[model samples]
Target: MRADRLVSLVLLLRQHGRLSATALARELEVSTRTVLRDIEALSAAGVPVYAERGRHGGFVLLPGFRTELTGLNPDEALALLVAGSRRGAQAFGLGSALASAMLKVVDALPESYRATAAGAAERLLIDPETDLLSRRLAAEEVPDAIAAEVLRAVFAGHKLRIHYAAAADASPEWRTVDPIGLVTVRDRGYLLATRSGADRTYRLSRILAAEELPEPAQRPDRVDLDRAWQERSTRFRSGGDQVTVLLRLDPARREELAGTALAVHAEKRDTDGWLRMEASFQDGRHAVWALWQLGLAAEALDPPWLRTALHDRATALATRYGTPS
Candidate 1:
């Protein structure tokens, strides 16, 4: 591990000519003390590394020092750089590996195109957590050790024993499943697997623990994960406890309603110029949450339960605010 780390340290310095101890530690995912020790190690190993003191000063390597590794063209290097900026790799416990690989990619770029490619990559953003509306899009947290074990099982073609909690408050249940693939959508990781020959997808965040079994998994030699994921998604959307609701929506908010619903069964314009929609949602809770987001712009007409839920929530909020100080 130290050998790998030392090599990574050298690669890091070789990639970015100058970086502060703090900066290096941040990039290395280590502490400053560890970084200092590494610098000494590098120096002892004859790495032409040195330090400069004062503000705007940091560790620097001798000029013209280079590694033999090379050969990414401008477009290839730019593509790698752009891909490296994404956060999905972290979900699979490959964040450090990705960082080291990106550094190597940058270090390998022909100087003629290195800076230009990096600059171009910097101008492009991929799968940013937030949108133009400024709403925070948070990723679910998955423990690295658990994710790593799951990844190991997936790659090794072994059955995985998982302690999974179907809901936040539920007790974890142990299950041995043959992992088919891993899929991430909207930053949430899911493990696609079969338990007792039944398709089951478990959220990575809800996995309390994971153990890779010695027995080889019962899975196909090759899988089309993309197609598998799409089919699973289609089944999920169509098989849930669906609640159909008639909604009177503002024309401007029609798209928002459609976006939140499982399906917009029908849409028509009322004489009053309001958009009427028959929409199906996954469940009662989903319907409530979706309609709540529209405030007064959307009204749940047919579903008495949905209307009652909205009214209750509104009344509770009003009562809370209306109470005497």
Candidate 2:
């Protein structure tokens, strides 16, 4: 761990040119005294690290010093190159940073593996603008200023004030929240925060504006964001108005039904070679809508309301098309 910390210290200086002990302590999650000790150790080990004494003075390396820390193998290099190609970083306003980091990684890689890894990464497409069906996959546009403020609050453990556009309201409402973390899933970004001690996840794209407050965040010193996100997801999936329907469907349509259903409680083959499934939906309307899409391949066996809705829809369609007009 000490070795890793020393390497990180060197890389930080290399990347930022110079940094005060306070800044280094904050970035390394250590203390100023620890940073000073590490600086002395680096100097003792002939790392060419020097300190300046002045109002703006800090630790810096000799002008021509660079670390030989490119320890990645071919596969690791390719994995990083592929990760750099993803569009998810754009949601957090790190697209340019990712590009610069990738260039540095490539430059540091062994010359024999660098070109091959980059060429392979280019051939593997991710989140393409247009898919085979000609459907476009687009990422939400988050304003640079808003994203910067959100990031500042998250990293500095400060509170944030945001003007959020709720779907039910016509105008955006201002709310002060303690940002726990920022998450980017696919091409969308979400800010996981707590308002009045209740957990909330806000889409970054829907945040019309944001401001980082000077007040420290009211949250646990250490947060398990992944577990918190999972708990919230479980609550959302189970808290909705859910309805279950029994259906007999063609075996070939099993995937279609499963894809549309919230959950499949049971599945078994009937005596007539049809697959019977008990599936849950968001509500009766959702069940009816999904069944309608299957047409003749699926039949709603129970929950007479769902069957009636499907029958009504089929009758209306037949009446309209069977007319002499």
Return the top candidate by TM-score.
Answer: 1
- Stretches off by above 4 angstroms in model 2 are 1-85, 168-170, 250-259, 271-274
The lDDT of model 2 is: 0.81
Total clashes in model 1, counting residue pairs 3 or more apart in sequence or in different chains = 0
Model 2 CA lDDT for position 112: 78
**lDDT tens string, model 1, 186-219?**
6778899998888889999999999999999999
Model 2, 1-325: lDDT tens digits are 4655576677677656799999988777689999999999899999999998899999998987877864544323433544654665678766544544454575576667866887887798767888789978788888878887898899899999999997636589999999998777657889999999998999999999999999999989898878988888777667778888999999999997887887899999999999999999888888888998898999999999888888898899999999798
Q: lDDT (CA) for every model shown?
A: 0.83, 0.81
**Clashes in each model (backbone N, CA, C under 3 Å)?**
0, 0
lDDT for 110 in candidate 2 is 68
